[model samples]
Target chain A: MTKRAGRERAGRFLAEGAQAVREALRYGQVYEVFVTEIAAARNSELVDEARAADVPVSTVTDRAADGLSETVTPQGIVAVCELLDVSLDEALAEPKLVAVLVGVSDPGNAGTVTRVADAAGASAVIFAGDTVDPHNGKCVRASTGSVFHLPLARSRNITAVFDACRKAGLRLVAADGHAKTDLTRVDLSQPTAWVFGSEAHGLDPEVLDAVDDVVNVPIFGKAESLNLATAAAVCLYAGHLR
Target chain B: MTKRAGRERAGRFLAEGAQAVREALRYGQVYEVFVTEIAAARNSELVDEARAADVPVSTVTDRAADGLSETVTPQGIVAVCELLDVSLDEALAEPKLVAVLVGVSDPGNAGTVTRVADAAGASAVIFAGDTVDPHNGKCVRASTGSVFHLPLARSRNITAVFDACRKAGLRLVAADGHAKTDLTRVDLSQPTAWVFGSEAHGLDPEVLDAVDDVVNVPIFGKAESLNLATAAAVCLYAGHLR
Candidate 1:
């Protein structure tokens, strides 16, 4: 369950915490729920909801729960849910807004971006080209259950994804702080896929060239740039608000 | 050096990584710089800048550098600088845009909000009433050197801080997602101090009451709310873009 290969082989992943597990039960293919006795006693609401949904509830010892938790302070709720990831074609099939994380390895940033994409009413989230697996436990936790609610795809072949987007009539806009065009000036009303890169190295040159244009989130202060997830949120929301 | 009390008593904190150390040397009161022998050899530009500034540059072993690092992957550069924190009065004085972080305990969020405030052309940043210390090492690192570039203040008494902001002729706008007024509709041309709260419980009711108005960043999608740092950045940049 800890290894990516293990989760992949099992065709399932763990969704931890009350909120995320709750969301999985509500909108996702949740198969099993694990709860500590204390948690079962304290969080009757979540346990009841799970039982009402016909999901099996297994009681685990506190020690067992501790072993399964990823955080320093465990929330004592976990769900084994079916893998919900889709293909790039399914993600970008009918997109007004698409959030593409290009080589964003940090699970927190990737998950937060997925949540932001969902909040922005994006059609799909594509983790294209060397991005972290969307099913990673930390990434799933960070998505705050949005991972269960959206079509997420990961592909190493970024070029093909860009070609598909172009063929689908979606403009490709890379979020580069060094770009000449400011975010405020970008016409986000167009069907567009916003691309963001890693915290260490930004977008690759070929990836930049594959896009229609690059846009910079306007920096008014001395800070160099926004965090990838925040920048993605700002860009995607700009399109949504448009 | 690792303990908060030690950092405060010494009136200095470590700024880690190339970018943070470089920024500490530029706009901060950098008293000393530490670089691993390998870092000194590899990062000649930063070493030369430190030497040019007449700051004592001590070469440490790789092991010693690891002790100074707060991140999982150490960047091999650290700066010990005089505490750059200012008084709340100093932060609010003559300020067109000021960002106030209330009860934001996470160093990453506090540091990021400070950087965002600086990027938004804010005159100052106030970490008020149970907020993380601006000089905390992780906060300093997350700021990417904006910690040294702007006026930053820590105050436990938020009430007086709000009074001072009002007296300074700055509107106190709390960025509450549940507020009726939309962020886009807010008049950002006026001098404003944007207030944000912790990741868990948002702003205290009293804190919200003290504000001139509460403005919500419009959410077009299903995600409940923005991260504190991201929400602060969006609000600050909105004022900047205006």
Candidate 2:
């Protein structure tokens, strides 16, 4: 359940908790829904909904459910859903706002950024240049079904992503902490693709140079900077609010 | 290294990664610094700074460093630092802007909120009523060492927290999705303490009732709600920008 190879081989992944499972049933290709006796009793409505969707439901013991669960406190309900990866071109074919994650390896940060991008009305999210797999269980759970809600794409070549964004008529904006221009000065109303880097490294110098512009989220306090996910939220929401 | 009891007994916690270790040395009571040989070579500046501060530096094998790391991909650098905690009264005594996390059990979320609070120029952060311990290794790492930048407090009683906020003359604002007022409409320039709840359950009814007002971070799109950490960032930065 934890390994990328395992999820890839099965072509399906587990979605835990009622909200995620329900979302999987609604927007994703669900193979089966697994619920412990207690979870079935607690979430009869969701189980019934899954059944109505023609999705198979399996009843497992609490111990078995615990074994299948990854979280410390199991939600007792898990859904097996087909992978939700879309090609970069397909994801960006028709987009207004886009979020490009460059080598964002932390599942929590990746998921949080996806959720924020979705919340900010971004049209698509692209995991570019060695970014963590979007299908990782932790990423899926952190996204809270956002991975299903929006178009998601992945690419190894960051240059190709930039080319696609340019072809899609999206301006490439890098979110850099050291940028001279602040985020507030930038006009995000136009179709724009915001690029963010990994936790350990900011955007590569080459990637930064290729972007149309680099902007910084203003830090009014003594703290060095915001976390990766928080920075993405602030930037994306700024675009939405603008 | 994982247990809260052990950290409490030792009155120290591990701060992982170069960023966190650097921040700890700059702003925290770092007792010792541990780095893998590769990290030592790659991060000579950090090692030199640590040594310059008269702090003990230890070179350990990658495996030993991994044993001390809480993250999946060990950053190869860790710092043993004194617990960064303050009394609730001390934290609230002179706070202008504050963040009060209620029942936020996820260490990642808790630490992210602390980091956001610091970046937003908040005077202090309080983990109130069944919240995760600030000294927890995961929480410390997630803070990116902002856990040391400002005062942090913990309380088992939410009511006591509210009482302290009231005594401090800070407006209590609870981040509620169902609230009538949107965050943009709220005047955040005034002294305030924003209260957030756990990922599973938002602010308890009792806690909500005791707060001065309830506000929601408006969702412009289909995402049901923002992740806890992201919401904190948006809300806190909104206050900062205002």
Candidate No. with top lDDT: 2
Question: Which stretches of candidate 1 lie above 4 Å from their native place?
Answer: A61-76, A240-242, B1-9, B35-39, B42-44, B59-77, B240-242
Model 2 residue A97 distance off true place after TM-score fit, in angstroms: 2.6
lDDT of 2 by residue, B201-238 (tens): 99888888898889988886678998788888888877
Residues B1-242, model 1: lDDT tens digits:
65679888888888888888888888888889999988888888999998998999999988999998877899888988888888878877778899889999999888888877887788998888998888777888788788888888888999988888888889999999789988878776679999999988899988888888898877666677778877776777775444
Candidate 2 has what TM-score? Answer: 0.79
TM-score of chain A of 1: 0.95
Cα lDDT tens digits for candidate 1, A86-188? 8777877887888888999999889998988887788888888889988787898888878877788778899988887887779999999889998888876
**lDDT score of residue B133 within candidate 2:** 92
The superposed Cα distance between candidate 2 and the true structure at residue A164, in angstroms, equals 4.4
| Model 2 lDDT tens row, A142-183 | 888899999999889999999999999999999999999988
Query: How close to the true structure is residue A126 of candidate 2, measured as C-alpha lDDT?
Result: 96
TM-score of predicted structure 2, chain A:
0.95
What is residue A176's positional error in candidate 2, in angstroms? 1.9
Q: What is the lDDT of candidate 1?
A: 0.84
Q: Which stretch of 10 consecutive residues in model 1 chain B shows the poorest summed lDDT?
A: B233-242
